[model samples]
Target: MEATKRLDATEQALMLITELSMKHGALMFYQAGGCCEGTQPQCFEKSSFYLRTGDVCIGTIYEFEFWLDKDLFDYWKHMHFTLDVTEGIGAGGFSLETPLGKTFIIKYRLFSELELQNLEAVRINEI
Candidate 1:
C-alpha cells in the first residue's frame, strides 16, 4: 500500500503559500509546541529561520518543507497535520503571512490504524 503523508495543506493555505512564495522567494514552516507562539505554526523565508538539530521534517506543502520541534514531534508523531490559515496576525509576528493579515495554523487528526501502518517516515534534518 502507498504510504500516507504525515502533512497536508488546505486550499486556502496553499493559495496563501503561493502568494507568500512569490513575495518572499521561498518559504518554510515550523511548528513549535508550547506556550505563546509555540502553539502556532510559523512561516518564514526559507533561509531566515535557524533550524535546531534533530528537528523533525514531517513533510512538504507547496514544495516547501514543514518542520516541527523535536520534542513536539515526539508528542504528535502519531497524528497527521493539515496546514491551515486564519484571519489574524500570529502571536509572534515573525511569520511572513502576518503582514497580509493571515497566520499559518495546524489542524491535526490522529492517524487511523491503517494510516499508521502506512505512514510516511519523517526526516531528521532541515532543508
Candidate 2:
C-alpha cells in the first residue's frame, strides 16, 4: 500500500519536539531485514526530533525526533512495533498515510533534535 503520512517514534518525537521543545524522549522504528534475505536488522533513532517538510520520493515529510523526560521515555519505550509504528525498513524505504491528504517518506536515517544537539555539542567541544 502507498503511504500518505508515515510516522515513527523519531518522527513523532520530532513532532513532539517541535510542539514542545526541550522535551526528553526516545522513539524507535522497526527495520525488517529488507524485502528479501540476509539483511541486517536494525533500528533508526531520533532524539528530540521536531518539524516536517517534504522529500522527492515520499512527497511530504513529517520530521520527527526524540525529546521527552523519563516518564515520556517510558511511554515511548512501550510504543515499539505497535503504537507509533509506521513504515520503512531501515534506510530509505518507509512511508506513511495521514488524514490531511499528505504522504511522508523517510529517505534517510538522520539524528533527531537531541542527537543533533549532541552532535552540535561535540562539534563545539572539538572547536
Candidate 3:
C-alpha cells in the first residue's frame, strides 16, 4: 500500500543524512534481524553495499542506499506509513499504523546502547 501520509518523517531523515553525508560521504540504514520486538538500524559509511540472499531494494534518495529484509518488506505490503515530527526529536522516522491501532516505529539511531546496557545489567545481576 501507499504511505499513509506524506513521508515527512523520511524527508527529515533524508535531510539529516544529507548533512551527515558531507562528512561521512556515504550512509545507509541496515536492516538486520534483532533478537527483540523491533528492528535495529545500523548506520555506516556508504562503501558497505553488499546485498544479502534475501534483501529487497528500496528506493534511494539523497545519495543513500535503502533496503529492507524480504520478510519485512512483505509483512507490511498493505499498510500505510507516515512521519511525525516533534521538537528535540530531530525529525523522527517512519511509522506503520493500521486501522486496528497496531503501530510500528522505524527510527535511526547511532547504536543499540539501551539494549546493551539493559542486557549487561540484567546478566550481571543474575549471576
Residue 126 of model 1, lDDT score: 47
lDDT of each: 0.87, 0.28, 0.42
lDDT, candidate 2, 63-88, per-residue tens: 33222222223223222221232433
**Measured by TM-score, how close is model 3 to the native structure?**
0.48
Over 1-127, each residue of candidate 3 has an lDDT whose tens digit, in order, gives 2322211246655555566577667666444464542453434567465656666544344545555666675553232333222233221233211221332235433224443333211001011
Colliding pairs, model 3: 4-81, 26-46
Alpha-carbon shift of residue 99 in model 3 (angstroms): 36
Candidate 1 lowest-lDDT run of ten: 89-98
RMSD of each: 1.7, 16.1, 16.2
List model 1 lDDT by residue over 21-124, tens digit each: 88888888888866677768889889688889899999999779998888778889998999889898747757788888788888989999989899998999
C-alpha lDDT of residue 27 in model 2: 31
Ranking by TM-score: 1, 3, 2
Give the top-scoring candidate (lDDT): 1
Off by over 4 Å in 2: 1-97, 109-127
Candidate 1: Cα lDDT at 33: 66
